[model samples]
Target: MANHHIDIHHVAKLARLKLSDSEAATYTLQLDHILDYIAALDQHDLDAAMPTAHAEAVFDVWRHDEPRPSFTNEQSLANAPKKSQGQFQMPRVVEE
Candidate 1:
Protein backbone atom coordinates (compact mmCIF):
# COMPACT_ATOMS: atom_id res chain seq x y z
CA MET A 1 0.00 0.00 0.00
CA ALA A 2 2.82 2.32 0.84
CA ASN A 3 4.56 2.49 -2.51
CA HIS A 4 5.55 6.15 -2.20
CA HIS A 5 6.96 8.22 0.66
CA ILE A 6 4.48 10.05 2.87
CA ASP A 7 4.57 13.84 2.73
CA ILE A 8 4.14 14.81 6.36
CA HIS A 9 3.48 18.48 5.58
CA HIS A 10 0.88 17.58 2.95
CA VAL A 11 -0.74 15.07 5.29
CA ALA A 12 -0.87 17.68 8.07
CA LYS A 13 -2.51 20.18 5.77
CA LEU A 14 -5.06 17.60 4.62
CA ALA A 15 -5.89 16.67 8.23
CA ARG A 16 -6.15 20.38 9.28
CA LEU A 17 -3.28 19.85 11.71
CA LYS A 18 -0.91 22.67 12.67
CA LEU A 19 2.12 20.53 13.41
CA SER A 20 5.37 22.18 14.48
CA ASP A 21 8.70 21.13 12.95
CA SER A 22 9.40 18.72 15.83
CA GLU A 23 5.95 17.12 15.58
CA ALA A 24 6.27 16.70 11.81
CA ALA A 25 9.70 15.11 12.18
CA THR A 26 8.42 12.69 14.83
CA TYR A 27 5.41 11.70 12.73
CA THR A 28 7.61 11.25 9.63
CA LEU A 29 9.95 8.91 11.53
CA GLN A 30 7.00 6.91 12.90
CA LEU A 31 5.41 6.63 9.47
CA ASP A 32 8.72 5.52 7.93
CA HIS A 33 9.13 2.81 10.60
CA ILE A 34 5.59 1.53 9.93
CA LEU A 35 6.17 1.45 6.16
CA ASP A 36 9.52 -0.28 6.67
CA TYR A 37 7.84 -2.95 8.82
CA ILE A 38 5.22 -3.48 6.15
CA ALA A 39 8.00 -3.81 3.55
CA ALA A 40 9.68 -6.43 5.74
CA LEU A 41 6.42 -8.35 6.08
CA ASP A 42 6.06 -8.19 2.29
CA GLN A 43 9.24 -10.30 2.00
CA HIS A 44 7.61 -13.33 3.66
CA ASP A 45 7.06 -16.56 1.70
CA LEU A 46 3.33 -17.27 1.75
CA ASP A 47 2.70 -19.17 -1.48
CA ALA A 48 1.67 -22.26 0.56
CA ALA A 49 -0.08 -20.31 3.31
CA MET A 50 -3.78 -21.09 3.58
CA PRO A 51 -6.36 -18.32 4.04
CA THR A 52 -8.07 -18.60 7.44
CA ALA A 53 -10.40 -16.72 9.72
CA HIS A 54 -8.19 -17.33 12.75
CA ALA A 55 -4.60 -18.39 13.46
CA GLU A 56 -5.83 -21.14 15.82
CA ALA A 57 -8.74 -23.54 15.33
CA VAL A 58 -11.98 -22.21 16.71
CA PHE A 59 -15.56 -23.57 17.12
CA ASP A 60 -18.91 -22.19 18.20
CA VAL A 61 -19.30 -22.42 22.01
CA TRP A 62 -22.72 -20.80 22.18
CA ARG A 63 -25.83 -22.48 23.58
CA HIS A 64 -29.18 -22.93 21.81
CA ASP A 65 -31.62 -20.01 21.90
CA GLU A 66 -34.99 -21.26 23.23
CA PRO A 67 -38.15 -19.62 24.49
CA ARG A 68 -38.53 -19.36 28.27
CA PRO A 69 -40.97 -18.12 30.89
CA SER A 70 -41.62 -14.40 31.09
CA PHE A 71 -41.28 -12.19 34.18
CA THR A 72 -44.28 -10.44 35.75
CA ASN A 73 -44.56 -6.60 35.85
CA GLU A 74 -43.75 -6.50 39.58
CA GLN A 75 -40.88 -8.96 39.20
CA SER A 76 -39.36 -6.82 36.42
CA LEU A 77 -39.61 -3.65 38.51
CA ALA A 78 -38.36 -5.23 41.77
CA ASN A 79 -34.88 -3.64 41.47
CA ALA A 80 -35.96 -0.23 40.08
CA PRO A 81 -34.56 2.66 42.12
CA LYS A 82 -37.56 4.80 41.16
CA LYS A 83 -40.96 3.69 39.81
CA SER A 84 -44.34 5.31 39.17
CA GLN A 85 -47.59 3.58 38.19
CA GLY A 86 -45.65 0.21 38.14
CA GLN A 87 -43.23 1.58 35.53
CA PHE A 88 -39.61 2.71 35.81
CA GLN A 89 -39.15 6.52 35.94
CA MET A 90 -36.12 8.59 34.96
CA PRO A 91 -35.13 12.14 34.11
CA ARG A 92 -36.67 13.63 30.97
CA VAL A 93 -34.32 13.18 28.00
CA VAL A 94 -36.39 14.76 25.20
CA GLU A 95 -36.84 18.47 24.49
CA GLU A 96 -39.81 20.30 23.06
Candidate 2:
Protein backbone atom coordinates (compact mmCIF):
# COMPACT_ATOMS: atom_id res chain seq x y z
CA MET A 1 0.00 0.00 0.00
CA ALA A 2 2.94 2.33 -0.06
CA ASN A 3 3.77 2.59 -3.74
CA HIS A 4 1.49 5.60 -3.54
CA HIS A 5 0.33 7.40 -6.69
CA ILE A 6 -3.27 8.42 -6.19
CA ASP A 7 -4.09 11.78 -7.71
CA ILE A 8 -7.74 11.68 -8.65
CA HIS A 9 -7.62 15.28 -9.83
CA HIS A 10 -5.57 16.00 -6.77
CA VAL A 11 -8.21 14.26 -4.75
CA ALA A 12 -10.96 16.33 -6.29
CA LYS A 13 -9.06 19.49 -5.55
CA LEU A 14 -8.70 18.71 -1.91
CA ALA A 15 -12.30 17.63 -1.44
CA ARG A 16 -14.09 20.76 -2.61
CA LEU A 17 -14.99 18.28 -5.28
CA LYS A 18 -16.78 18.94 -8.55
CA LEU A 19 -15.23 16.07 -10.39
CA SER A 20 -16.44 14.89 -13.80
CA ASP A 21 -13.73 14.14 -16.20
CA SER A 22 -15.74 11.00 -16.17
CA GLU A 23 -15.67 11.47 -12.45
CA ALA A 24 -11.94 11.74 -12.45
CA ALA A 25 -11.64 8.66 -14.60
CA THR A 26 -14.01 6.81 -12.39
CA TYR A 27 -12.23 7.72 -9.23
CA THR A 28 -8.93 6.75 -10.72
CA LEU A 29 -10.00 3.22 -11.44
CA GLN A 30 -11.84 2.95 -8.20
CA LEU A 31 -8.84 3.99 -6.21
CA ASP A 32 -6.72 1.50 -8.09
CA HIS A 33 -8.83 -1.38 -7.05
CA ILE A 34 -8.92 -0.27 -3.48
CA LEU A 35 -5.20 0.13 -3.39
CA ASP A 36 -4.69 -3.26 -4.92
CA TYR A 37 -6.76 -4.80 -2.19
CA ILE A 38 -4.59 -3.10 0.34
CA ALA A 39 -1.49 -4.31 -1.42
CA ALA A 40 -2.77 -7.80 -1.08
CA LEU A 41 -3.21 -7.24 2.60
CA ASP A 42 0.43 -6.39 2.97
CA GLN A 43 1.62 -9.88 2.21
CA HIS A 44 -0.32 -11.50 5.04
CA ASP A 45 1.60 -13.19 7.84
CA LEU A 46 0.40 -11.94 11.19
CA ASP A 47 2.81 -14.13 13.07
CA ALA A 48 0.14 -15.99 15.00
CA ALA A 49 -2.03 -12.89 15.57
CA MET A 50 -2.73 -11.89 19.17
CA PRO A 51 -2.52 -8.17 19.89
CA THR A 52 -5.85 -7.22 21.37
CA ALA A 53 -7.15 -4.12 23.10
CA HIS A 54 -10.71 -5.38 23.39
CA ALA A 55 -12.33 -8.12 21.43
CA GLU A 56 -14.23 -8.56 24.68
CA ALA A 57 -12.52 -9.89 27.73
CA VAL A 58 -14.28 -6.99 29.31
CA PHE A 59 -13.41 -5.32 32.68
CA ASP A 60 -14.17 -2.29 34.90
CA VAL A 61 -16.47 -3.89 37.52
CA TRP A 62 -16.16 -1.04 40.00
CA ARG A 63 -18.67 -1.21 42.94
CA HIS A 64 -17.34 -1.27 46.50
CA ASP A 65 -16.31 2.22 47.56
CA GLU A 66 -18.39 1.67 50.71
CA PRO A 67 -20.38 4.60 52.13
CA ARG A 68 -24.07 3.83 52.55
CA PRO A 69 -26.19 6.40 54.36
CA SER A 70 -29.06 8.77 53.79
CA PHE A 71 -29.70 12.50 53.58
CA THR A 72 -30.57 14.74 56.59
CA ASN A 73 -30.02 18.52 56.65
CA GLU A 74 -33.57 18.92 57.96
CA GLN A 75 -34.58 16.14 55.59
CA SER A 76 -32.78 18.08 52.89
CA LEU A 77 -34.42 21.44 53.40
CA ALA A 78 -37.77 19.69 53.07
CA ASN A 79 -38.36 20.88 49.47
CA ALA A 80 -36.90 24.37 49.38
CA PRO A 81 -38.07 27.04 46.96
CA LYS A 82 -35.27 29.26 48.35
CA LYS A 83 -33.26 27.99 51.33
CA SER A 84 -30.48 30.18 52.72
CA GLN A 85 -27.91 29.19 55.38
CA GLY A 86 -28.17 25.51 54.61
CA GLN A 87 -28.16 25.89 50.84
CA PHE A 88 -30.27 25.75 47.57
CA GLN A 89 -30.84 29.36 46.43
CA MET A 90 -30.46 29.76 42.64
CA PRO A 91 -30.92 33.01 40.66
CA ARG A 92 -27.70 34.92 40.10
CA VAL A 93 -26.44 33.01 37.11
CA VAL A 94 -23.24 34.64 35.88
CA GLU A 95 -23.42 37.76 33.74
CA GLU A 96 -20.48 39.89 34.87
Candidate 3:
Protein backbone atom coordinates (compact mmCIF):
# COMPACT_ATOMS: atom_id res chain seq x y z
CA MET A 1 0.00 0.00 0.00
CA ALA A 2 3.07 2.24 0.28
CA ASN A 3 4.68 4.07 -2.64
CA HIS A 4 8.22 2.68 -3.01
CA HIS A 5 9.70 5.68 -4.90
CA ILE A 6 9.00 8.33 -2.20
CA ASP A 7 9.56 5.78 0.59
CA ILE A 8 13.14 5.19 -0.54
CA HIS A 9 13.99 8.90 -0.43
CA HIS A 10 12.29 9.34 2.95
CA VAL A 11 14.14 6.35 4.42
CA ALA A 12 17.50 7.51 3.02
CA LYS A 13 17.03 10.98 4.50
CA LEU A 14 16.01 9.63 7.92
CA ALA A 15 19.01 7.29 8.03
CA ARG A 16 21.41 10.10 6.98
CA LEU A 17 22.40 8.13 3.88
CA LYS A 18 23.48 9.74 0.61
CA LEU A 19 22.77 7.77 -2.55
CA SER A 20 23.85 8.79 -6.04
CA ASP A 21 21.21 9.86 -8.54
CA SER A 22 21.85 6.76 -10.56
CA GLU A 23 21.55 4.56 -7.44
CA ALA A 24 18.26 6.18 -6.41
CA ALA A 25 16.83 5.78 -9.89
CA THR A 26 17.87 2.14 -10.01
CA TYR A 27 16.43 1.36 -6.58
CA THR A 28 13.20 3.22 -7.32
CA LEU A 29 12.57 1.08 -10.39
CA GLN A 30 13.54 -2.14 -8.57
CA LEU A 31 11.38 -1.35 -5.53
CA ASP A 32 8.40 -0.39 -7.69
CA HIS A 33 8.67 -3.68 -9.53
CA ILE A 34 8.69 -5.59 -6.23
CA LEU A 35 5.62 -3.71 -4.99
CA ASP A 36 3.84 -4.42 -8.26
CA TYR A 37 4.42 -8.13 -7.70
CA ILE A 38 2.94 -7.85 -4.20
CA ALA A 39 -0.03 -5.94 -5.61
CA ALA A 40 -0.66 -8.75 -8.06
CA LEU A 41 -0.77 -11.20 -5.14
CA ASP A 42 -3.40 -9.06 -3.39
CA GLN A 43 -6.01 -10.09 -6.02
CA HIS A 44 -6.02 -13.72 -4.86
CA ASP A 45 -9.16 -15.00 -3.02
CA LEU A 46 -8.42 -16.52 0.40
CA ASP A 47 -11.86 -16.12 1.92
CA ALA A 48 -12.35 -19.84 2.62
CA ALA A 49 -8.85 -20.46 3.94
CA MET A 50 -8.57 -21.11 7.67
CA PRO A 51 -6.14 -18.91 9.60
CA THR A 52 -3.24 -20.75 11.21
CA ALA A 53 -1.49 -19.87 14.52
CA HIS A 54 1.65 -21.86 13.72
CA ALA A 55 3.21 -23.69 10.79
CA GLU A 56 3.06 -27.04 12.62
CA ALA A 57 1.11 -28.45 15.57
CA VAL A 58 2.85 -27.93 18.90
CA PHE A 59 3.00 -30.63 21.66
CA ASP A 60 3.80 -30.53 25.37
CA VAL A 61 7.32 -29.07 24.97
CA TRP A 62 7.86 -27.18 28.23
CA ARG A 63 10.32 -28.49 30.83
CA HIS A 64 9.14 -28.96 34.45
CA ASP A 65 10.52 -26.39 36.92
CA GLU A 66 12.45 -28.00 39.74
CA PRO A 67 14.16 -26.69 42.85
CA ARG A 68 17.96 -26.88 42.97
CA PRO A 69 20.65 -26.07 45.54
CA SER A 70 22.18 -22.59 45.14
CA PHE A 71 25.60 -21.24 46.11
CA THR A 72 26.00 -19.39 49.44
CA ASN A 73 27.32 -15.79 49.75
CA GLU A 74 30.83 -17.02 50.73
CA GLN A 75 30.94 -19.51 47.81
CA SER A 76 29.71 -16.90 45.32
CA LEU A 77 32.34 -14.34 46.41
CA ALA A 78 35.22 -16.88 46.40
CA ASN A 79 36.34 -16.02 42.83
CA ALA A 80 35.68 -12.26 43.00
CA PRO A 81 38.60 -9.86 42.43
CA LYS A 82 37.80 -8.25 45.79
CA LYS A 83 35.40 -9.09 48.68
CA SER A 84 34.21 -7.23 51.80
CA GLN A 85 32.17 -8.62 54.73
CA GLY A 86 31.38 -11.89 52.87
CA GLN A 87 30.21 -9.97 49.76
CA PHE A 88 31.79 -9.10 46.39
CA GLN A 89 33.17 -5.52 46.17
CA MET A 90 33.38 -3.36 43.07
CA PRO A 91 34.47 0.21 42.19
CA ARG A 92 31.90 2.99 42.61
CA VAL A 93 29.62 3.14 39.57
CA VAL A 94 28.21 6.69 39.90
CA GLU A 95 29.96 10.09 39.87
CA GLU A 96 28.71 13.27 41.50
| Candidate 3 vs. true structure, TM-score | 0.39
Write down the worst ten-residue block by lDDT for model 2. 1-10
- lDDT of all predictions, in order shown? 0.86, 0.81, 0.81
Task: For each candidate, give its TM-score against the true structure.
Answer: 0.37, 0.23, 0.39
Kindly report the root-mean-square deviation of model 2 from the true structure over all alpha carbons.
15.6
The residue pairs that clash in candidate 3, if any, are none
Model 1 TM-score is 0.37
lDDT string for model 1 (1-96, tens) is: 445367999989999999999999888888977887778766889789888988787798876699778899999999999999999999999997
Candidate 2 residue-wise lDDT, 1-96, digit = tens: 335458888777888989878878777877887887788766988779888998888799788899978798878988998889998889899998
lDDT string, candidate 3, 8-69, tens digits: 78878998989998988778788887887777756988788998889998978986699777
Model 3 vs truth, CA RMSD: 9.8
